[model samples]
Target: MFSNLSMGALGLTADLPTAIDLAAKHGFGGVDPDLGYLSGLGGTSAVSEFASSVSEKGLRWGMAGLPINVTAPGTEFAQQLAELPAKLEVLNAAGVTAVGTWVRPMHDELPYRRNWALHASRLSLIAELLADSGIRLGLEYIGPKTFWSTERFPFIHSLGEALELIVEVGAPNIGLILDSYHWYTAGESADDLEGLSDADIVSADINDARDDRERDEQQDLDRRLPGATGVIDLDGFMSALRAAGYDGPVKVEPFMKSLAEQPVDDVLADVSARLAKAIG
Candidate 1:
């Protein structure tokens, strides 16, 4: 397992090279490159340079965000899909092996079942696209009941439900980007993950919650750093992942605004230390 720091919570808004340097300096094995930065640098040639820089710092490219929306309308979605092949080529060149995204409900007017089917169909096609590029697609499910209540139609909000959707999608390259905050809010325990295999989990996000707040009341922006709060059992969560054979990077994704208040280097150091202790 390794640590990743591309999430907005870390407040590290430096350029890609600076971010990778900070990640290595702070003892993280890898860093997720900002896709926008990558694009600004130019295409395949720039990606090659970025990969070389990462290797020089003894770090690996962990993950990158997808630029296109696969669930958009027919023509828009097709255009997005068309753009994916080139993106995959860039990722492959950069040595990034995973693409991460959340499964959000897009149409408020649609029924839940209809939305689910639509998601499955689109994700299945996406899985195929990633498969061709030899990259895995890490799909995240938003697990907060509050989030569901705010949505027009309910969607997959638990690991079990996400896993079922992955099965329905029927793509070997499709898997969950499990988040501890989501897991806790979903009211799921470590034991609930016992049946999952390593392949079922493409990546993971590790963050704690405020003990004083109720699970449903805790918002995404209110998360605490891993092991900094006692609400989520970090040790148990790691143990469960180990038991399930997950060996991917476990990223810190706390959305605390306080992190942004601190110096970026200080925040990175603190988060890295906390994650090391939690994963140990």
Candidate 2:
């Protein structure tokens, strides 16, 4: 997989043009441009220019955040769903091949079965739209036990459950955003990843958990740079991706306050170094 820069995930506030420039400057092969921002640029001419600029910089579009809000109720969800095609059309012109969003692992009202159905129904529709544009959609499962355990109903918190949801959706464009942090928190092994083919993964995230927290107690937002403390098995994780022949974007998503607070260039350089060190 290639190194991709995700500005929001890295806690940077760079706009699309600046992000593209920074990504290339920082040695990232790809950049996750904001879909909403891209949409705002308007029309075919603007999008073509932007795409050309990225290509000229030797960078490609990585997975963007899925613009549709899957959890909004009835009419709201319908409105977002209806507007997706237009947004996707813009993304298509920009040469974006993939988009992804996370699945909330728990629900206060809906139980497992109902929640699963809701997600499947909504995601299936979204996936169909993405499929029409030759784009893939990746669904990320939150794995930290602490995030889901205290809720009234736990939904998908593991790779197995995520696969089940994908199966239910049964859309060819549906895949996974395989993440090192979640894989570790869910107590999954490299063997689990062995079962997946490259196409099964749309994108990936590489990060480390805090050493002080037990696996089950780790918070979702609290993370370290890959290999920072050797608390996560990053080597094994990268090995699995290589073995699976995953050639998609593999981004660093270390949600660390210190890193976020640093200058944009410092954050980019640090992540580039850590990612190279972890995956090399």
Candidate 3:
């Protein structure tokens, strides 16, 4: 596992050039690709030029957020799906091989079975689209009970459930975006991750839960930087990744309120140090 700089996840703001500079300066091995920044450059040629610059700095590309929103209405989803090919072209030119999107753990109207099929169908289409560009798609499972409780029906909120959906999608490129926050909240152990190989995971996020709350009581956004207070079992998490031979980027996704209030440079330096400590 290698440390990755995910600017938005850390609540830091910078242009692509500046983000790359910060990533290199902070000792990150990878930086999450800013899809908006790449798209703004207008074409594959411009994106390739920018990608070369990042490559020269010795930073590998971390997973990019999937541009299509799976939870959107059917028409909107179709439109986004239609536009996916062009967006993927830019990512391919930039050498980004992985992208991810989260699944809402509940739905207002759809029951569990219906919701599962809906997600499987949508994600299958996306996985196929990504595979055409030689990219892998990571599907994130939202594990906090607080999130799923808000709706009428609970969907996939655990690693096993997410794997089931991935199988339903039935595409080779479909995989997991294994997150420590979710892994902890879902009552999973390091043993639960032992079954997965490197190919089973496309990317990962490392964060800590607040000590004040029990596992199920945790909220998705109420997280600390990795190693903060040692509230979460990060060592076991990293050990499992190693056991699985996972060589992908591991980015911090701490949605701490205090972290969001700090200066970008301070947040970057602090997050970088925290990640190094946690992973080591």
Candidate 4:
């Protein structure tokens, strides 16, 4: 498995290549450039340069960030769907093998009660676009504010629902972005991660949670680190991955405010240590 870093760690201070270098130097094998990073590099030319730069650093360029709203209905549906081609083109130009979106099932739909149909439709459309460009699309399961099962944000309550969406979309280029925080926040047990493979897991996010669905702001502060500081079952999750034959990156995507103020070396060291314990 590779050690990966999401550009969200650096916020707005660093540039694309700088992030990649940081990750590589810190022993991360891959880098996921946030959408803002791509936007800053301009268009096609920038994407090509980014791909080249990441490869030069011996890091796999993974596309991270959510830009498409798969839960939209009707006109807004067409709007997000229309944007897929350009997004896929951006990934293609950037040499990004996979595109990850965190808000696919969370927002972007109208009166979205029938979330199943909304998600499946958009996934199919976007999957086709990404397939044309040989880029895989990943659906990241995360919460917007409240945890899953309580609200209709981020992702749904059922792991089966997310899995079914992927199966129904039925594209080899389409897959799941499994996340530890989302798993706990959504109330899914570690046993739920059975039967998956490296191919099914296109991307993954790691963050731990310590509390229940209390207040939105409070939950945000508690979720960070790995399975160590939270109520999450990390050992069981690692066992599940082994059962499913997954060998991929364990991306540190904690949104905790504490890590934001820490120095890059210290922050990376902490995250790297947690990843080592989890993935070792």
Which is the leading candidate under lDDT? 3
Candidate 4 displacement at residue 217 in angstroms:
12
lDDT tens digits, residues 166-189, model 4?
888788887778877667656677
What are the runs in model 4 whose C-alpha is more than 4 Å off? Answer: 9-13, 39-46, 103-113, 143-145, 149-155, 211-221
Ranking by TM-score: 2, 3, 1, 4
- 1 against 2, candidate with superior TM-score: 2
Q: Which consecutive 10 residues in model 4 have the weakest lDDT in total?
A: 212-221
TM-score of every model versus the real structure? 0.94, 0.97, 0.97, 0.82
lDDT of 3 at 186: 90
Judged by whole-model lDDT over C-alpha atoms, candidate 4 comes out at 0.68
The TM-score of predicted model 1 comes to 0.94
Tens digits of per-residue lDDT, candidate 3, 160-231, equal 999988887899998999999999989899989988999999998999988898877888988987887687
lDDT of 2 by residue, 1-280 (tens): 6888898887778788898889889898889978777778768679878899889999988898888778888999999999989888898889889999999999999999999999999998899889999999999999999898878999899999999999989998899999999999999989999878888999999999999999998999999888888888888999999898888888988887777577889889988877777557
Clashing pairs in 1: none
- Looking at model 2, residue 273 earns an lDDT score of 78
Name the TM-score of candidate 3: 0.97
The residue pairs found clashing in candidate 4 are: 71-109, 72-109
Clashes of each: 0, 0, 0, 2
Question: Whole-model lDDT, candidate 2?
Answer: 0.89
Q: Residue 92 deviation, candidate 4, in Å? A: 1.3
> Candidate 4's error at 153, in angstroms?
9.9
